[model samples]
Target: MNKAMICFLLLLSSPVIAQKQKTVDSKINHVTVFLSRAQIEREVRTQVEAGKTDLIITGLTSQLDQQSIQVAGKGNFIILGITHQQNYLSELNTPRSLRILKDSVEFFQKQLLIEQSQKEILNKEEQMLLSNQKIGGTNQNLTVAELKGMADFYRTRLGEIVIARMKHDDKIKKINERLTKVQQQIQTQNELYTRNTSEIVVSISADAPATVQLDVNYIVANAGWQPLYDLRALNTKAPVQLNYKANVYQSTGEEWKNVKLKLSTANPNQGGLKPELYAWYLDFDQPIYRGLQGKASGVRIKSAAPAMAMDKEEDAMEPPAETTADFVSTVQTSLNTVFDIALPYTVSSSNKPTLVDIRKQELKSDYLYSVAPKLDADAFLMARIVGWEELSLLPGEANVFFEGTFVTKTFIDPNNIKDTLSISLGRDKRIVVKREKLKDFSSRKAIGSKQSDSYAYAISVRNAKTEAIKIIVEDQVPVSQNTQIEVTATELNNANYTQETGKLIWEMTVQPNETRKVVYKFDVKYPKGKIIPAL
Candidate 1:
């Protein structure tokens, strides 16, 4: 036979193996959660028959981004295609531990229902007997012996019913208590107990029987994280300790038990295209609204970045007894930042925030006492932190601690364009401050068609603490918007005055047990016929 004829015969003789279908569970190995979304990585290991196989991986979040599904594997096989779909039948796709908790909850709940029903039946029997208690019936008369026997029977029956009801009630109470405990366990586990989840179907071509390990990863919309911070200061002399952390949450049905957790600052959902300036036209302002200021808005995106991965890797540093910040390593990129946690963490899919330690550092700060006695009677301790540009800090609320006591909560805004980050510690009662209008300088007079008002104020801050402290005093005067209204500073008292804003600031260091005073005087004049705004 010719060569072409021989090839055709050989191809016809070869076997055409059809693809076999199978379902396998995946283990969540790593998760890199962004500010609004998280990328979940799972590994699947299973045995495949010769030829072709279609593996369906169950128990993934149904809210995952379909376009972000990625599958790669290491085996003697070639992956053909990957597809995602909702799995209505995979309600039991949760891990064994979570499944046990759910089962226990169901068991206790059923038991509670049974006990309650028994109690209800006893109540019904007792109510019926009491309502029909007319000896035998309304029309029938009973003998003395019959009456006595009937009374005894009624009493005995009623007593039995009451006892049975109490027993049932006791059982119900215990069952309800057990059920509550089980439900709490479920909540703490954070396992999503919803019916609808997701599954990935992968088609692969294999030549022989072998084991295939597939690494599947996808981005889920239901999981994300936000930044949190703890700023503690022992005293003004030492540096401020900034403890960086994150609040991670997810509702994905799969529990991330002891998985490698990576907190990233890279926002995959961030707009890729740079923003363009729109056209601006300044015409006569139309009457749209009054006293409504225009606000500039921008998008805030949290991002995620990744580092090297391994089965067993030593932490950068051993975690302290209270904090795990030392075990976290920081990774920086041009666009965002990332913190790789070496320790394994179990984060249930309960959608509640699970605190994760990022890192901690000592930040230098300039401390001072601040008081605007006109607005507040107490002095607040302020810390001005500089050189925080390298920290890759996110805008978040911070808990302030002073002298081992929680003072108050403040915010850390990385978007602030200033050179320093200012933090306010709680009010200090030791520094007594008082503001009063000086009656000697306060007066109002009218001259011709104009009115003039002179106002003077005295702010005093007395330090009762044993150590000397520095403080700033502030007061402001009203600025005139109309030409007919004029404002003038009469007595500056060596204070730093901003003419545009009509603000007076006095900064001084007061010795222990000394009282420092700040005095400023201002005058406002306007047309007497035309009423002016408040001064």
Candidate 2:
């Protein structure tokens, strides 16, 4: 043999030459999950065949995004680059990312429904390891005897291998520890982030099918008034009843269901006069809660009519002789006239009631009366005049009277009179009038002046009423850098003022409608050319 032929023969004879190491190029197959109808359909079909009742498309896409593939009849999901042991440990240890990993694992286990023996083997091994930990023994102390017992209990061939691999892999151990810490940090950070981000956004697709929008129609009904006669006086009392109905419908022209309804009454005088009457009482007894609509009812009882004498008492007592001068004077004053009449009944609703006085008052049975009541009928009543029409006393409506020598007075029913004639006449005549005069006087002043560095303003308020009253003073100023507004009211010892960007508020309770004043001063500074208006 020649030298070249000998070399070739030697190479062929060598084990290294005959059985050479093959270079295998490892490539990570990147999974790209394309959101399409076909993939979803396939997954749905597969899940249906496997007996899953609830299938979430988003969950399936999430599994694919994490590079996991689910195969039927497999005990666990297959992660291309991860070994079975590595996957298990990763699932046990990873933080927030564990949800995806766990779902993937569960998906595989359910699909495959691995043999009972294999599952029991894994469970036995896990229990043995847990028992060892309880006894404070390391994984290395898991002897062959323990392993054999676990294997025998579960009757699985892979029990020993699983235990050995779990104990000896440093990467797996470190991965678990790192995963646990990372998960804790992530959980804490996620909770903080969610707390900080405190709002949820829901997106509705513009391309989705269109539907009709819901509409609401509200109508006020049963708005009428009835007379509430005064039992003591021959005057008509009118009580008004108002009803409202709200009809709700879907944009598809269908009626709505289980809609909540509410009624709110606003008194226009709440912010101006008669704040005590600004209360709104809800009438829930007349609620229409079923079907696609609801209705509500409210009633306001007007003044009642005064009481009247039954039968012809005058005919029984013998009619007084007809006097020409006396009868003419009574008829002349019978027409509607503004009389400074003192109320006979007590005002129960409020602490302060209208007080007026009239001396030597007379009334007759056939005379007419035009009396103006000052209590707020309604805050939003737009009518310039609101009261019941004049009517003769009858069985339903009666009028009241204070009989004096040479005078016969008729009183309207339902009027909130403070006292009867005896009590009204006995009391000091000037007390009620003085109290009303003090209650009516209220004044406030605002001072606006320009400054070199900024604009400033001062507010002064006075309450001249005898009774204590609360006054709210608000000042609005230009918002600028280093703006300072100070409100001063020495009389308002308990008052406090709050400052916002361009507004200041001061609340004070003046004594007995007494003249309590407040002054507010504020300063604003900006560029010279920029002139901020004083608000």
Candidate 3:
């Protein structure tokens, strides 16, 4: 055969060079998958023509599964299958097909790489932007608004490229800020974790009870730090101002004033995130009070008058019967008994009588009388006595009463009496009685592990006066499961007290200008695993 004829015959017989074909047979009973039938036929034909049985079967199965096809029987001697699988062989072996596949893969890879790089760049830019924002007012840095605008502009021009970058950058900035904050917190916590020790010296007044158990605690770095020493009550309810001077050693002294000093019955909570009682800063340098001293006195006197005179002749002496009938002779005779008669009567010296001087003389003498300024209690008592006298004066007895106001004489003790000057008098004249009411009394610690648990508390009683006063402290404890109350004092004890039906009675007798401390204790037990809300 000629060369051209041989080539043409070979090409006509080649399965890879066959024309496209299709067939449908109702009797074959095969699943028809709606896919590129021409493409599948081309792939199958090319593999078969290459003398690869494995390739043909692999391609056929791959296409079938991808297109969701069902095969009824694998081995079937049918010309329809051969023709359908042989079509489109030339299309599958074309150079253009190979080139298109290569281009698709390269395009995908480039797209993935570009996305990744954009994300990285965005992350870096975001970190820079956040850093600049943190710097805020630095002169050489771009403002946050400008940087954000730039990012937005790039994003709009670059489609998803800018968006990926911005998101990556924002994530990085957030992570960095979080990490920095965590590191700072850790450093601060480490600095605060050291064990500290201090000595608290409390100097109480001599008039105070010889012993007192003061409940004290402090706050260190937002943590409750309790005192190591056990405050034992030496004298309960002693008459004195508790001048607490705590000297903490090896500690910051300023923190002491910030500590909460509670004199309550409940044991204080030592470890917690919340404060049981708000801590108060004490200013120890400030003077509590100024010292002022003054002296006062009161006096009383009786008078002597002619109405009670012993001279009956003078009283009976009638007026002269006539103006000239021995008037001088009658007067001389009448005065002869009262006067010496040897010397003519004349006023020796004019001396005005003063009740104060007379009272001073009486004070010097020993008599059944007491003298004190009529101020406060003493004054009240004096007024009561004078009122009684006014109501009980005898008839025609020539009684004399003086309504004298008090005067305060301020001077050095060793100074002369004449040098004493009056500072103030009759200022507080409303029969002053100062009384204090317990505004609020609570425990500095929770009764149970959580705030939901009920607890008992105590309050100190202070009477700012120079007289004995009585006070009654009463309160009801919050009722809950496994709760009990106890009130202890030097004078009274209320162990049976309950919130439902009990009253703690304290008949406290506070001395003049004194502070009295008292305590009430209670307990509350709650169920396990229960969280109490913040109060």
Candidate number achieving the greatest TM-score relative to the actual structure? 1
Off by more than 4 A, model 3:
1-456, 481-499, 531-535
TM-score of 3: 0.15
> Positional deviation of 227 in candidate 2, in angstroms?
29
Q: Cα deviation of 215 in candidate 1 (Å)?
A: 2.3
Ranking by lDDT: 1, 3, 2
TM-score per candidate, in order? Answer: 0.79, 0.17, 0.15
User: In order, what lDDT does every prediction score?
Assistant: 0.83, 0.27, 0.28
As for TM-score, the candidate ahead, 2 or 3, is 2
When summed lDDT is taken over every stretch of 10 residues in candidate 2, the lowest stretch is 31-40
Please provide, for model 2 over 216-332, each residue's C-alpha lDDT reduced to its tens digit, 9 standing for 90 to 100. 111111111122221122221222211111111111111111211111112111222222323344566874433332233222111112232222224667675431111111111
lDDT of 3 by residue, 1-535 (tens): 8999999999989887333222211111111111111101111111111111211121111112122121222221112221113222221111232345445545545555565677777567756655554433556688689879877865564655556667756665665565465555434433322222222222222222122222212222221111111111111132111111111121111111112121111111222133234334457797444333333321111111122112113445675332111111101122111101111111100111111000000011110111112112221211111111211111111111122322332221112223221112222232233222232532333445443232334445545555565444444434443343232222224433544553554545567667655455444444445543421
Model 1: per-residue lDDT, tens digit, 193-300? 655878899999888998999988888877888899999998888888999989999877667889988888877666455555545545577633333233433233
User: Which candidate, 2 or 3, would have the higher lDDT against the true structure?
Assistant: 3
Model 1 alpha-carbon drift over 4 Å, by segment: 1-16, 47-50, 95-158, 166-191, 207-211, 275-322, 443-449, 529-533
